[model samples]
Target: MRCAHCHEDNDLGLKPPPPKLQGVMRKGKMPSRAVATDQSVAQTVLAGKGKMPSFAGRFTEEQMRALIAYLRTDMPLPQQ
Candidate 1:
């Protein structure tokens, strides 16, 4: 599989790390942490958030869906 952001060839079996935490917190409020779930990753790729570039025009929705499905099967989540 290729990196959605860089287009560099990445092993489909390799699991990507979660996105870094962002946003400010009020007093006694917990920090906002965003995970790298399959859905989030697809949205990020489609919307191009942060360091991720959008794949909206580059790939068709069906292609994106296939990629997501492949990733889900090839890259299992790490043990907590």
Candidate 2:
């Protein structure tokens, strides 16, 4: 399933609830570790881990950078 599927409303009742990503960028407390660097987080998104599936080719380089940048911000990305 997609990230929004679990993160959006976040009432799916799945075991091991998916993380709420609203402030993950500012928090730097991803399930993996503290002080998550942009490059390392990008690697996790691209490679996936455990239950999360890989998205290796789903995004262009530009798009990937944009995603990372969005996650790095303290504010929520403005609505599309």
Give each model a TM-score.
Answer: 0.46, 0.73
Tens-place lDDT digits, model 2, residues 22-74: 67777767766645677777888899877767889987799888777777775
lDDT of 1 by residue, 1-80 (tens): 33532333332333464332221111212122445565665666687765455667877778878766655454432222
Question: Model 2: runs farther than 4 Å from truth?
Answer: 10-13, 76-80
lDDT score of residue 25 within candidate 2: 70
Show the colliding residue pairs in model 2.
Answer: none
Against the reference, the lDDT scores of all candidates come to 0.47, 0.70
Instruction: Give the clashing pairs for model 1.
Output: none
Task: Rate residue 31 of model 2 by lDDT.
Answer: 68
Error of 2 at 32 (Å): 1.9
